[model samples]
Target: MKIRSRRFKHALASLSCAATLLLAPLASSIALAADPEKEELKLGFIKLTDMAPLAIAYEKGFFEDEGLYVSLEAQANWKVLLDRVITGELDGAHMLAGQPLGATIGFGTKADVVTAFSMDLNGNAITVSNAVWAEMKKHVPMANGKPVHPIKADALKPVIDQYKAKGKPFNLGMVFPVSTHNYELRYWLAAGGINPGYYAPAKGDITGTLSADALLSVTPPPQMPATMEAGTIHGYSVGEPWNQAAVFKGIGVPVVTDYEIWKNNPEKVLGVSKAWAEANPETHKRLVKALIRAAMWLDENDNANRAEAVEILARPEYVGADAKVIANSMTGTFEYEKGDKRAVPDFNVFFRHNATYPYYSDAIWYLTQMRRWGQIGEAKPDSWYFETAKKVYLPEIYQSAASELVAEGKAKAADFPAATEEGFRAPSSDFIDGLTYDGRQPNAYIEQFSIGLKADSKL
Candidate 1:
């Protein structure tokens, strides 16, 4: 009986050992399952503080957290960056929100580009050259020796008229034809009763000023201040540091910010080729995870890390602008006219308010703008807008990363859109002109705009 009992005990111990072995592989599989795809990645960006999330993700090891070895490169211009992404030279890029939409729609280049992340909100401002600002200030309203916030272009209308009467064009610069700077500049100018003009690509007039009061041209971000200083352009609309650079060099005065034009506006996005995304879905999700973490770090605690972000952007590899220049708008205050500083806490929002999610509504808005201004010549059905937005903004891929973050307790459900979400935002009326925009009814929205081409309207 004693021998039989000892044999029974040994069998029980063996069963326990077997159970431990079974559970060990399960845990190992769970851990190994979390590893990233395509461990090495190269990303591109223009020299704007809006690209800080990419720099911060790399610098703070967020990419490493996802097992991604990322190399962030600053390209010469937006065109080069977009081309590189199309050709696989860049895995992804910090791009204009319109860039992916434009590329997918074959505005400049034919490529299937997608954005799962929006890099930032409201990092652009319009600045006028010192000479033009001097003339504009004479017409602007002042109280307590300060120009009122959101100094409208009404003040500059007469200056443009002077140029018009003199038979010389009133030239201004924006980064790209489909850029936020282009649209925002146009919006502000149109709102203040300035004719920013139209694009007739079909007519071979890509200059975008068929009949104009102000001839808006495309100048790359880094060239804005230098172009203004050389008197080549009277004013420009651009993202970060460059606007403040105008103030530092005494070349120009920033008249209004996009935040003032449209509060908390979506700006740049992280774009990748459709081929890259399809071939390496896991790598794409991992990249989104790293960026989302970096964006959170940037906006956490009411932007406690903004100082560090400004420093990172000032480094030669990122924005490469003067630290003081970058700090002007990056650290919660923006310098407009020389020494005229104001508190703008949300000037460079990165993560909060669902800023990282690539909303289909945001994509549709850019497309609507393109259609409104003759970039898209003919009227497209509302379904076309929805289809185009879905093509460019991949909410499915974004949700994958968001789900992983929630499961790991890294982020909360409240931080993103609800688990069951419709791609479109509930009709946004937040534009500068207070025009209600229902992405579902894009043609109606385009028709309501006071300026540019509308439904059945051609350049």
Candidate 2:
């Protein structure tokens, strides 16, 4: 009887040990889950309407809800913003979509930057000085005594030619070399039979003016209108409210919005250093969640909150533009010629159409533009584009944040791309030029263009 009792006692002790082993890992995982590694963060942004995601996230308390106390600073310009992110002076920042791709590939600065959240879509436009617009208006087709919508670069072509006829340089301004504005301006010019020029980085010519019809240069976003007004640049492509500021100041006329350049194009993104992301995984994911929520709020009920957003963006500490100027684009209308306000509800998309998701295809599109110009300086296989895109765009982190939003009932699952989405959007031909682009076929897409470098054409 004594031996049997001891056997039972030994069996119970083994069962207890097994139970503790099973429960221990579960407890550890529960503890590790959702807790931020670093809660206090310093984020940077340029003063643009698209920087609204970070602004909304802060003013709306999305960061604090995740136990993060974030301090937002307005960087002087895109270069300064990118530099701060690279040097760890900022936890993350509102970045041009191409900024991360440009940095990773050694275009200007070499850094391992990754983005999971795209800040907004279709916020940029091409605006010409009043004097330039007067010449352009003569060539533009009109309707009902008003200039027609989507005034293309074809209209500006005659103006550029007139400048060339008089031995004058036709200068255009873009935000950055690797910026979407740069690519869009070039695309518009090339489509209209104008040579916007090329960058032969390998040949030590960053001027991008080899056999060019229009000279393109970088002007800071805020200074763009003033620079154009000063006659330093005849026209400029930049994000709002500067374009609207031109009309308000009676200094310029916005010729085209980026929506007409590339319909539903991906614009700005929230970028972080790869090292910072790895070291603080939880914090990074939570920050994306906050940004996602902010995006959703911006687009909720088809921009019901935009008036509030415009107010927030107009503050001196933020965009610092007049509320009316900011509202010109933010509130579903854009002023082209001072009084030519038209409805463009998608003018500033924050969340709808999966704008927040960082797709590898978007990265590839930017890279193809870099190569098409002279920034890439060489021809690479399509696989190289794919691999580079995956390395730079952290879609896995986007999924994690999106999944949390869906699970908590904060957002619907249908609002995100399918969990099985391959990070490439369907091949689209929605640009003003009507050129179809398949991200999977970068080389073929390059061959489609009449101007710019081709697959065999190297700078």
Candidate 3:
């Protein structure tokens, strides 16, 4: 309804634009291209602050600028969101970075899902209950009467061992089996010599607790605080608002952020079925363009707009968390322990560091984690990794959309990766364990992980 009223106002203004356009020839030449194949779209998202791109695009009229009227619906959970996208119940949805790759590879629900846009980076943290934190705090190194930053999983390892000694399951919650939260949590735990466990899908054991020292299960993001409070789980790995929710509730303390786990790690993406993309290529590119604009707005001027963006995300139609909770991390700062707020401007990065680029390296990293954890039961060549990443992460589509924006002078050419980019990021040793990852060499990267399945290893 708001979009309709906005369109009506635009129509009224267009009647007076002819005279102005005649005086400004450059503006007339900069007009948008043909309308999208599908003008009306319903998109889906989970209730997380990282979904800010979709909310901003809708609220700021970016979608309408591309001649698209969009509806944003919050899904019940990740699985339902992915299923709806596959079934075309929604045009596209905000998805975990691994969802498209996982679906394409037949990990859970086999389908040809693809993404042309990455939504954001580094918006997750691992939090522990006050009880767990109390025990873990004894192991953590302290400076200035507070736990040192980037509290390694080694501190939590002793607490997990104690729980095992008592014969109690040390369960943790991630949003989904193939979620970035699952892999990031596993990575942090394994880096500390704790086995977060393996998935034996080949033997029909999809639960990833086969050899885990800590059992991990899926709990929806909104329910993480309540679940940890109920003692059903000791801690959780999740996106913002929820992690901050735990601190506000005073039931838990965030131990480490994903930015500390692996700096600027890819988090979420805009996913659609291959069928929908092929059928509406123009519409797909237009959608990516609008989302790109939204992301730029979110991170521009050193995040000057983040406060207003937080207010929009706090609305009932979006993330719906209290504005204070969303602002805790969204406003360029993260509160770990109570009264321990620290500056982490990149914690919820939307566009900076080329955050919106759908890099094949990012996709291959997820595949490497899946293989390392045994969800990918067998090993594959590096070539397979590259090919699979290309199939799912369509950087060409993203580049096409970005080029349009640059041509329109809405974004600078330097804001995106070069056209000659081969889709892999440069090698980096940014993990908590300081392991180097070269996306071009997936098997080598997988072999470097001591706790996971090594090269050619079978479950």
Candidate 4:
């Protein structure tokens, strides 16, 4: 009644083999779903430590893991970098937080630039030439033989007034018109009752000093020290190595960092043209994921990796300055006067304190500053500010990339903004003057400050 044992065993083995073949494609489909659309990419950056994320991402193979090949190149300046991205000569770039907004609004160059990734936070300082610092030191308050921290612009205002009364222009340098340095410098000067001038687009004057007390102008970041040394500018606001270079050369003293002006302020961003982003959405998301990983690496272990990062930044193509000079600020310490080094752990934050998130509040703050200085030229309704911020900051893109990382088990949910995030941060009153800023009520916030042109005010 029984069949042959060999034939029965053969049939059972054949069925099991078929089942294994059927399930193989299911697993393969899961793997293939995670691969990036485009594998090769080109990104641009300036010679600054904040660009460490791009370097780290490329060196650490984070991009490779995402099936992306990336090349990091240093641009001559912010303008050239932004221009390349706009013209599609580069895929994206390490950008000034304002670059994307400024470009989108037709400030300097007209393009639809967008950013989902903020590169870092609080990596800039305002440095004054030694001669200027010596003159202002008399007005600064001394505590325990050291000038008080967050040295107010009040001290510098008197020095500038002296220059003005003597018929000399009080010139200062910022890297760009819409740069954080320009806004921060203007904010500090305005807080101290110094009019930093205005930008009159209607009058064909973007010089930003239409009846001003201090005439502000643009100087490339690396050239800040030389510009000041040549007497072309008396002071400057720029990202590090340049500021620290001045101190090492016995040329200047850094009065304050952007952190003191606006705590944990957003600095640079990963900028790309809106057209490029749309055409290569998958590639853009993969790029963001890799950058987020690099940012976490930069800030991981409380910046234990900064010394190594400074070394990488010191190479010729990168910052190209002495490691010691870059380390002065990169390693959680900053020197004020010669030999006055102090701990400022957040001076160069890359990822912590929500540094990677491109908050709508941050964009609105810059917009308010523009309006304050007559850059906007007229009263904009609160809706216009919010809409403009939304146009430039692509939170939706950030979410897509973060979700992909989570799905791949490469990142955790806690590492990113919550699903319930409203894009805007809570109202903050952490300014140097203790004034409150609410992104939703920008005009009201602008009116709270003692200085700056308000709604409907022109130069």
* Model 3, C-alpha of 164: deviation from truth (Å): 0.9
Which structure is stronger by lDDT: 2 or 4?
2
Task: Return the TM-score for each candidate structure.
Answer: 0.93, 0.93, 0.95, 0.93
Candidate 4 lDDT score at position 410: 79
Q: Per-residue CA lDDT of candidate 1, range 1-459, in tens? A: 002223444565678877888788677566555555577677888889899988888888778778677777789999999999999999999999999999888887878999888888999999998889889999999999989877888899999999888899889999999899999999999888988888777887777887778999999989989998998999999998899999999889999999999888899999999999998888899889889999999999999988888887888878889999998898899999898999998999999878898888888889988887788877888989999999889988889899999998999888989878888778866767778888788888888977778887865
List of clashing residue pairs for candidate 1: none
Encode model 3's per-residue lDDT on 107-214: one tens digit a residue. 999999999999999999999999999999999999999889889999999899999999999999999998999999999999999999999999999999999999
Worst 10 residues of 4 by lDDT: 1-10
The lDDT for every candidate, in the order shown, is 0.87, 0.89, 0.93, 0.87
> Which one wins on TM-score?
3
- Model 2: residues with Cα > 4 Å off, grouped in runs: 1-32
**lDDT of model 1 at position 156:** 92
Clashes of 2: 1
TM-score of predicted structure 3: 0.95
Question: For model 2, what is the error of residue 10's alpha carbon versus the real structure, in angstroms, after optimal superposition?
Answer: 52
* Clashing pairs in model 4, backbone N/Cα/C closer than 3 A: none
